[model samples]
Target: MIIESNDERGSVNRSALRRLTGIDAASFAERHWGTTPKFTRSAELSGSFEDLMTVDAVDELISERGVRTPFVRMAKDGRLLEKNKFTGSGGFGAEITDQVDSAAVLSAFAAGNTLVLQGLHRLWPPLIAFTGELVRELGHPVQVNSYVTPAASQGFSPHYDVHDVFVVQIAGSKRWTIHSPVHRHPLNNQPWSDRRAAVERHADDSPELDIVLEPGDVLYLPRGWIHSAQALGETTVHLTIGVASFNDYDIAHHTLGALQEVEGLRAPLPAGWDPTDSEAVLPHVRRVLGDMRRALDELDRDPEALQRITERIASRYDELVRPEPVRPLRSVAQMGALRGQDSIRLRDGVIARVVRTPESAAVVLRDKTVSMPPQCADALELLLGGSPCRLDSLPGLDTDDAVVVGRRLVREGIAVMAGE
Candidate 1:
């Protein structure tokens, strides 16, 4: 299915979500999210998998890149191979534990072991781009892992993931069996192993869905859904993109932290508090609870405070972002060479938004915030539009002021030189 653009602002472009699920984002969220499993079959999606990763690319990462453990793991007959079995000293006198032993990995693969590539989004360029887009669309952190299994072999036992996963069949085919969750809406700390007997029984019983996923098929399983997969006739390669959704616990934790600014909330509890005597602690507890209630009420009424919390949670995911390597001398030279006709664009994965208060305006990106004078508001707005704009074309700033703003953006890694 083709992704269709939407005109609504701040609404998730349903195109990508539709491409994966064959349904609009809103419908999917309303109907299936954390409730059931979904399988979408499309011929167009099969070819798009090649744009994310290929068999040749996988081989290159394993053999030529010297990838080390825990990045690459091998599993056979439901058991994970130890890191020492597939890793060893690096070549050219590098550290003893720095490289993966490609020979050992290939030998294991030939013996019917499934090779699992972890965190491909961090190591593979294609996945980095694709998963980054997924993160922005879903407003959550996304991780990608690839599983290459031999024909007629299974990699792991029946289990459930703590995070929701989109299973993209990239090559060949695999048979997937999905069962009802042993625990509904399980948190990250909950694992299938914690309910091993229940999971085993569920796997043996009737499942909600059982089907062969061919190339171009996408299967989505919410957290805590029991499932397992085995390769079909040909060797199978599939990508599993995990989405870690933020929940109420995260908001509550941040809210508590924000409430720490209240001096009453920061005061220590009674030194001789008696745990068994409710009367002894009643006064102090009542006061503390009252203070917390009032603080939270105030925070809910303050838009700026709520926005700060939202930005904080959003920026926390930026830790997973790997920025482009900046060359000091070259970047400085590029900044100095900027001309009035030169066009610049925001770097990929660099998010910039202008935050305005009555007194001042600030451009916030990732971990950096640059407060600017009120006069630069129009120029900042133009730059934050995220398109290529010539320096001289800024709406309000003159050539000199524009140069200053442009230099600051470039130096702060928010924008890059697009073209002359």
Candidate 2:
């Protein structure tokens, strides 16, 4: 169950989970990852997340950022408040009617609403970096949201998330009441609302863990673990980093999808047979199942089938997570200003693959594909090998040709200049 990753230089990088939980990835994977809950104090982990978030930062985002609906939401007594309560139009030049009204947010907060800042990883700089690192570490897409609760208030009712979460307490204290899962390892399509009766019943049973989380504390809860939290005396702000991990079902789904090309599996059942009659349908079902079993066995032995599955999973990853942010204007400028002395490398967090077709060598990015002459295949490989290389040093191409290729890559968002 141990999770491991290598840097571009092939050295093992420290695991982000270990950094956050003060437990190495091997032990965490063996014991708590997708298995159980583990809570650790701030003193135990590397350090407090004061640099990541704070009360002042929250104020700035609400009052200055011109945030809109879906980004800012408020809840109280386990029910969400209407958007109209804290949202209104920006006057004159900017007329987005649903922008958050800071004054209204203050009034709502005073009335005991818990502010939920969704998608903080995309909004806040520090969280953007941290979440990206965690995604790389776990090979799972990660998202972050912040919960700012007023004293003596609860935001949501007892419920379970479909994704695993690391709850990092940043300010004040909050008491968390945790219970064992009513339905273990629920998928994205399986929500607590689907089984509310069972969740509520389990929530009422004797608690499994109940403790107050002070600033610098963290709680790791696997998916489907029922839990609820209430803010303590002072206001509370915490970040919930959700991990949408791929599982066995995903592998099987892609594998079966590849199997669709098999002729035997696609054959129709007995045309005149009564589907409702057990005697008539049982043998047909068994025969089809036997055919599918044989097809699966053949697929297991075929390397090409495994390659297709890997590509399918990689495509799914491309859809789930975004690469590092690109500055369009700056990057465009850098493209035109490329110099032989400038160092460039593949953009961090980018999902790309160098593919060779009969016609050309192409670098496939999430959003687009950049194609080059077949002569550039070796140069493309050298450029995308993870480490930064100078524009003049691209192996096959001369200085001028190397710059041309480098500029194109930068312009296409496949690579970036060093120190960016």
Candidate 3:
């Protein structure tokens, strides 16, 4: 969407993405939107005087309806810190349970204590919309994972988020260390359990910016900003909007999705064949396995799927945050041939470069990411990421231009079915 880069003020508006090292939200986001970790401070990436998510209609819609779910061991504290692991029990005596964490951790927060929040969007819709709006305003797809902490008997220990974060100090004053990126682009998309270890490895580089943020103030940390916080007074509430990027590791995961679809690939091995009988293996069997490997090579032909997969991932991280923001897409439509589609917009999800397809009405998510039927592509192209295509007549999907646009959507995840 034509993000403005290399500006003098060291900040940016939603229209043009500005890039400042400490203020590099738009530039860095465009580059590693789904891969590398990036962070920006007020001076670095000074956002304009725009009031994001200010509409009463939307603000009310995405407000916290109290913690709709239960707090797990990891979220026992207001901030998700030491107990962030999703696997083994920690020395802190925290354990993971299957109980659903609420949209907002009210019970734990009501007492004004530190706590860990797990998946706020699952129980809330407004938060999801807020996150989605932020992504759209930023002109990028991002997921929204939120964090709200109350000042209590204890404070959160030093830690980092598992994704690139845009912190909106919504309700109270919260302090942050605003550390440097541990790894130039640490994957916050990595499991919560693994984040601390990554941070520990880079703890030596955890330089601090030391800033206190109040409501309406925004703080950004490229995925690995080593920071810690405490309530300014009794409690502090903030929204941490994260964008989980997809890197090579993510590309590696798409293969698993493709394998699930390929029939010959899914077929079971010959009867009685077992790895336990390794001593009885045959050369032909080995060659057959090589053939399967070749199948993957064929699957990787599309250059777009990887980008699509990464963007989808990035958007999910965007749609999970605080109050939903409204994109002026309606204005964009007026400028071009924008027509509304009654498609399912991912609730609390982010997608990028969605376009319409030619033949089927299918919507594809990351056509470059994986294979899909044709009909579903069009809806996806329009619905996912900005298709980067010429906006054409939107009088249904029967015309020639419609077909071309529809095909693009099938490739992206903008629609429900294939493009025709």
Give the top-scoring candidate (lDDT): 2
**Model 3 lDDT per residue over 302-349, tens place:** 566555555655544444433232334432333244233322233223
Task: Give Cα-based local distance difference scores for all models.
Answer: 0.80, 0.88, 0.46
Error of 2 at 381 (Å): 1.3
Tens digit per residue, CA lDDT, model 1, 1-420 = 112335342323224465577666677877886677889886634135677777888889998987877888999888998888888888576776847888988888889999999999888877776675666566667889999999899999899999999999888889999999889888888888999999998899998999899888999999999999999998899999998877777778777878867787777776877878888778877887888899999999999988888877666657655554455787799899877888777776666788888776798877678887777787788777777878888877888777887888888877788841
lDDT of 2 by residue, 1-420 (tens): 245543232212345666678876777888899989999998898666877899999999999999888988999988999999999988998788899999999999999999999999899988887777788778888999999999988889999999999999999999999999999999999999999999999999989999999999999999999999999898999999999989999988898899789977777776788878998888887987788899889999999888989989889988999888889999998888998888899887777778998899999876788899877788888877888989887777788988999988888888899877
CA shift of 360, model 1, Å: 9.1
Each prediction's TM-score versus the true structure: 0.83, 0.92, 0.49
User: What is the model-wide C-alpha lDDT for candidate 1?
Assistant: 0.80
Where's the lowest-lDDT run of ten residues in candidate 3?
411-420
- Estimate the Cα RMSD of every predicted model relative to the unseen true structure: 4.5, 3.1, 10.8
> Which residue pairs in model 1 clash with each other?
none
How do the candidates rank by lDDT, highest first?
Answer: 2, 1, 3
Better structure of 2 and 3 per lDDT: 2
> CA shift at 45, candidate 1, in angstroms?
4.1
TM-score of 1: 0.83
